[model samples]
Target: MGGNEQKFIKEAFDTNWVAPMGTNVDLFEMDLKTYLSNNVHVTALSSGTAAIHLGLILLGIKAGDEVICQSLTFTATANPILYLKAIPVFIDSEIETWNLCPIALEEAIIDRIKLGNKPKAIITVHLYGNPYKIEEIRAVADKYQIPILEDAAEALGSSYKGQKCGVFGDLCVLSFNGNKIITTSGGGALVSHSQNIKSRAIFLATQSKDKAIHYEHSEVGYNYRLSNISASIGRGQMEKLDEFVNLRRKMQNFYKQLFENVKGVSVFEVPNEDYFSNHWLSVITINPSETNGIDCDDLRLALESENIESRFLWKPLHMQPLHKDFPYYGGNIAESLFAKGLCLPSGSNTTEEEKARIQNVIKCLFKNKIKKKIKVKSLFPKRQRLFEDNMLVNFFTKNRLETS
Candidate 1:
């Protein structure tokens, strides 16, 4: 919680505006609008999932429609497609950004069109706060005249080519879940370039209440409005959103330095300066072969044993039991990422001591693995001689030992 959260909440209580519709909600939306600076309209809602569901509805997705979604993201991205009874054609991630592959996306759209079921929308996620190949993906979508629903759930402060993420899609979704970069306790907002779309979303969110004196509903509606208390929190969070993003990026740099010399591990990073990730969660991919067979799960368990928490990356949706039967396009990139990637503890509030503890545990694990490999090699003289000669020649050739 930021400093002004309690103050805003208190104002809500003092004004007796405890309901969902209040000054806090209005101010929160405006704050987001100004922060985004994209001239987009925002409709704060109960959850990111709710925002996604409403976004799909606004996109006119319905029964029997097909939506193209990234296969490497959280279930929330795909669940809403099912909510509207739409078929999800899952696309794999590209190696560069770990986002929806443009080639696979075009292939899916072309094939679906050939089958006479043109996809209604594309749902691309900014996975773990890193923006996707925006220009390429947007070009593909434009070529097909398909609308994009940008899932910026983990990318509030991220950008591509200096443009904010939340404005890239025809409709974009922002999450304020407790684990997100900013928390409204638990809330989200739907972002749109059109005011009419925003108004329609608000109408549908608030039970489709008509302007009549008496309560009247002409269509199905949802109870997805963001409450006064939650919006108050959101208002406070917005004030510190940039600070949190900086802190998270600092954490990413910390991890980068920690693993820079670690042979088997490579930190996930932006492909170029044009892409700016909030680094919501600092992640890495471990190649066991380079580490003498210490894989990502091994490091996860080692962290757990040290009473520190780490997690494997999201299992690609195409492999999940519930979504396995769905039509999946592209190669094994997403699958390989699931096997090798690990997310370190990267909370904005994580203390320096905690970070030191995480680093120490990881360093010790790698040191021990190296020692064990050396001991085993010593037991075989011929192989040990060959390995030592290779190491010496490579070390001299690269001058790494001299630098150390």
Candidate 2:
């Protein structure tokens, strides 16, 4: 938590504006607009999944319409398609970005068109906060005349060729969940190019209530507006967005240095300087053939034994039993990566002591023969400590995470 969240929350209570659509929400949206540095509109919502659902609806998605989605991502990306009763055509990932493969994406669109039901939109993601091939993906989507619904859920600070990720899609989504680079306890936002679209989304989020003396609904809507308290937390978190991004990137550099000399270990990173990643999670792939057959699971188990948390990358949606029957495109690139991938300890708030413990576990697992010694560096070396107290978070937790 940032130091200012409590101050904002306190103001909310003092003003008795603890409900949704308060001053905090307004200012938080402005903060996002300024940071995004684009002429776009943002409406805070309940979660990224909600943002996706609303985005699909606004994009004219309907029952039986096909929507192309990245295969190797959180289920939230695809579940929304099912919510709208639309068919999801899964596309595999490219090695350069671990995101939607443009070739496979185009193939899916062409084949789906040949099958007589053209996809409504293309869902692109920046997996692990690394920006995908934005230009490439956009080109393919344009060629096929499909709108892009960019899931920048894990990429709040990411960019491609100097433009922000959220602004690239016709409709985009950003997540501020508890485990994101920054959090509002739990929330998300939908980004659009026009105020009219933003207004439409706001209306839908507020139960499609018409401007009547009393609540009146004419269309299907959701109770997904973010509460003033959550927005207050977000206002504080926005103040620390750049700080959190730098800290997350610092964690990525930490992993890069740790595995620089490890023959079988490869840290996941952006393909080029044109792509900037927040590196929300530092991930690596293990080639068992190079380290005397040490696989990803072997290293994961080692970390587990020491109680240093680690886990495999997301299993492709196409491989999940729940989604196995969906039409999938492309080769086994995503599958291969999953077999070798593992997410390391990459929390921004991790202490020096905790990092030392994690480093010891990894070094010991590799037989302590690593040439370079891992450093227990401070995440904030020259600034005042940001986290002043756990009082606010503790209080919120005690209150069952507070109301919407």
Candidate 3:
């Protein structure tokens, strides 16, 4: 955690503003508005899932209304659709960016509309901090005249063409869960372009209390307001957001460099300069054929064996038994990603020793294959270094060649 988290959190206790509403919550929301670089209204909530649920409510989603969703995200993104008893039409991810495929999205929209139930809203996600195909997806949503509930939970610092991720949709969600880039310990916020919508969201979050001043409610409500203490932590985390983003990007670069010459392993990256990701979790796809049959799980096990943890990418929601019966579009792209992708340790606080250990583990795991891929410099080269005689490569090569 950033050092100032304690300072802001202490202020919350010192002022006795420990509940959900107070100076901290107000300022934290303001901080997010300013950081989002948009004229969007913000209402801090208890969780990202809550924000999505409220967003769907504000969009007028009712039971049996179909909501289009990206199938490759965390369950939280899609669970809210089920919460409102709305049908979730899951879409697949494209290869360019492992996000909602615009083609599949348009296909789903057309088919659903033909079936007489036009989707109420599209729930798009910037999975793993990588922004979706912003323009393409937006075009599809606009053409279909469907509002979007962007799940920017993993994308607080991510952007596309200089615009931030959270502000891209009609109603957006941001997460500060413990595992997120910057955590309020556990919290989230909803983003909207309309102030009235923000006010309505706040009203619903606080038990829908009426103006009579007594505990009164006319509609179902949720205790979804973020705590003053958590907002205080968010305030501090906001201060160090740029620092965390920079460090996370460095981790991405580290993985890119480490895997540059390694066959079969390719680090996940944006397609172009238009996208800037927080690199929340550096991911890679391991192709078995190119790595002497080593796959993502093999690498994960190797890392685990060394006490360095790694994980597979999210299993597509549609593949889950709970969600298998849901209407789904597209082929096996999400399934392919789940099968081959691995999430590397990319925390902001990872130390130099930890980095070295991680590097050593990976290097050892792929040593045999990588040895054949890297070349040793020739002798008498300018600014020569060790192994100028092509010693290591030639030695290994000669040993194999001699045997052969």
Q: Please give each candidate's TM-score.
A: 0.91, 0.90, 0.91
Comparison by lDDT, 1 against 2, better one:
1
The lDDT leader among the candidates is 1
lDDT tens digits, residues 166-197, model 2? Answer: 89999999999999988999999999999999
Cα RMSD of all models vs. native, in order, equals: 8.7, 10.7, 10.1
Assess each prediction's global lDDT (C-alpha) against the native.
0.88, 0.85, 0.87
Candidate 2 all-Cα RMSD: 10.7
Q: What is the lDDT of residue 26 in candidate 2?
A: 90
Per-residue alpha-carbon lDDT of candidate 1 for residues 142-228, written as tens digits (9 for 90 to 100): 999999999999999999999888999999999999999999889999999989999999999999999899999999999999999
CA shift of 18, model 3, Å = 0.7
Q: In candidate 2, how many Å is residue 333 off?
A: 0.5
Task: Tell me the deviation in Å of residue 349 in model 2.
Answer: 0.9
Residue 111 accuracy (lDDT) in model 2: 91
Candidate 2: where is the Cα deviation over 4 Å? 368-404
Ranking by lDDT: 1, 3, 2
